[model samples]
Target: MDRPRRCVLLKFGELALKGRNRPRFVNALERNLRRMTADLGPIEVRHRGGVFIVSGDMPQEELAERCLGLPGVSVVQPALRCERDATAAADAAVELLRELPGHTFAVRATRRDKRFALRSIELARLLGDAVRVRLGLDVDLSNPDLELFVEVDHKELLVSVERLRGAGGLPVGTSGRALVLLSGGLDSPVAAYRMMKRGLRCDFVHFSGRPFTSPESIYKAYALVGRLDRFQGDSRLYVVTFGPAQRRLATAGAGRLQVLSQRRLMVRVAAALGERLDAGALVTGDSLGQVASQTLPNLAVVEEAAQLPLLRPLIDRDKSEIVDAARALGTYDISILPDEDCCQLFTSKPASTRGHPDDLRRIERTADIEELVEQLAESAELFHPTLEERAMVSAATPASRGPSLG
Candidate 1:
């Protein structure tokens, strides 16, 4: 008997419904999968109808877990490649079941190749009887303690007992590129993840209260970006120190409109950076009425300052939903770390919820908004969080420079 080889069975969700554009989406997903797992070792991806079979040097379970984070993938099954016969599949199933603890089990077989002698039900029944007779396990169809899967393809048969859920959406870069206004907060990182799920290849921009404040928030933002980079590799974070700019806003007698004015400037600076990076729009974590600065009126006032379109993925979502997503995305811990965010500096105790466009424009004039935007853009520091060497391009002052990852 030949030894069973481990492999991953990958399936996509929405990409399958793409009709004429399905191949393009699948190709994009393939490229993304390879890039995401390049560190693991070389891998081969073979497309068979709707599912893809990936074989590589890395452990199958580890490879499946890594592929789960990739967008466009719906399900990942780590299985053993066996001979294309019922006896081989039942043998593989018994081998897999021995490692998994379950008294009751169900065999679910899918026969994609008609050339197979037995039907799908026949294969399932054979495996189900084998597990029942040989392993002393009962069969439960509705709610089983374990679900053993046997997939029959043209060339081979795969048997497994576990199915991992993937990050279901279109492939990253399929929906074009956008820049996320990533803050050291709960909402923005979640917002960036949401956009990435929608296939937007997103880079991040973080505004830090440097010079007037400590580098704690910059470190937090750096950590946050590093966490998010796992979903979409080669993540870039541009940090702009805005303490001086905020001080100017405060001295301009903006009063209750201080936070609103600061937010507008941040958007302007982000838009400036976005232009150079060719980002079509800017993404934010604004949940409607979540804070005074996020009120509808204030949000509109801030949106006017952005040269590119502003996308708020969490606008309609409540705080709880955003928090839950943050926890799941693995950024909640980093975001909750104490740090003085740039917008929090020079902010009034009670910010205006209904900030008028004219008043913000007037404040912009007093602060020389365009010139300030230009300066902030020029001083932006670029960091690639995924790279362990702490590779960065420093265009800002020494104080604005990020701390060593070590």
Candidate 2:
């Protein structure tokens, strides 16, 4: 075996403040991280001195790639995670700068263990002072050419400056579960992301158009959510074919009414899925009046069927703002993939901008909406994101599956 060119270190940040619930939270985080990086190498997760360390045959750069996006992680700087001598420490610091674009930099050390006779400030100054004399560098604290931070733990040491970008929230499965209405569009996935950032575990309810609609669009939406789960860790998605119902309503002279009717059915389906799956609410991308179907009056008609709380995380956000957030979280590229969602099935005249709930109920009675619901419920496919492959596939695929809600 080519000797494992891997790096070992601990992750700490917000978990420090967590009291009794700390172990439960870290266990969930460590599990998710291992799942995401499993294929790359045999990654190991351990708890030490109020932090979790992952070690194995994985490079610091590649391992850092997936570790940064994990929730509950605050700092991910490189570490030795083992005992070190002064020569080793000094050599590591010097070697770090040797491949630099410039030669002028300093090393700052902090000794928390106190086993080292040289005090923290004393050791830091000497490291900097020695580097200045040996490498002809300048010591600039406020605005240094570069900074080498050495954090010494009991038996190990970490040396590096490539800081990891954490998800900066509580771990997944911490807050309660919620069902996300994932569309291939930009807003819904962004909505799911914002909620996940707040520690809300999510199960996506995707309404796809099948038989009448091509499989590509549904695949595109699944792919989008999967990308996020790769960043997040474990997420489940339910793919329900609502096309026959949507088509039936359209053919029944309800083209103008199809959008609202389908939405009510979506809410109804989500409510049942939530009940079965322990999800607390239904989250959507329905921004107020963003489109004809999302208008204030139309929105009310769409939401009339739901007994559960409807979470519109992006309700007040402008499209531009949602798009910016999506791009930052790496969802924008997949959201624009080559496919169309069920929403593209109709282009009605005037498109019912101002809808009345009572009228919607009357239409539902006349249109036999229960039949639509029956067809939709029977066709639903429960899909969870595959964290191992780092990609989304149909639930039927042998992949890294999650809890089944059926």
Instruction: Provide the overall lDDT of each model, using Cα atoms, as 2-decimal numbers.
Output: 0.85, 0.71
lDDT of 2 by residue, 299-403 (tens): 877777875788888999998999898888777876776555687675477678877777677767776877666656666786655644334434443232223
Candidate 2 Cα deviation (angstroms), residue 225: 3.9
The residue-level lDDT of candidate 1 at 222 comes to 77
Q: What is the TM-score of candidate 2?
A: 0.83
268-309: candidate 1 lDDT, tens digit per residue? 999999999999999999999888888887888899888999
Colliding residue pairs in candidate 2: 79-158, 80-157, 82-156, 236-384, 237-383
Which model scores highest in lDDT? 1
Clashes of each: 0, 5
What are the RMSD figures for all models against the true structure?
3.6, 4.8
Q: For candidate 2, which ten residues in a row score worst on lDDT?
A: 397-406
Instruction: Give candidate 1 misplaced runs (Cα > 4 Å).
Output: 387-406
Model 2 deviation from native, Cα RMSD in Å: 4.8
Q: Could you estimate the TM-score for every candidate? A: 0.92, 0.83
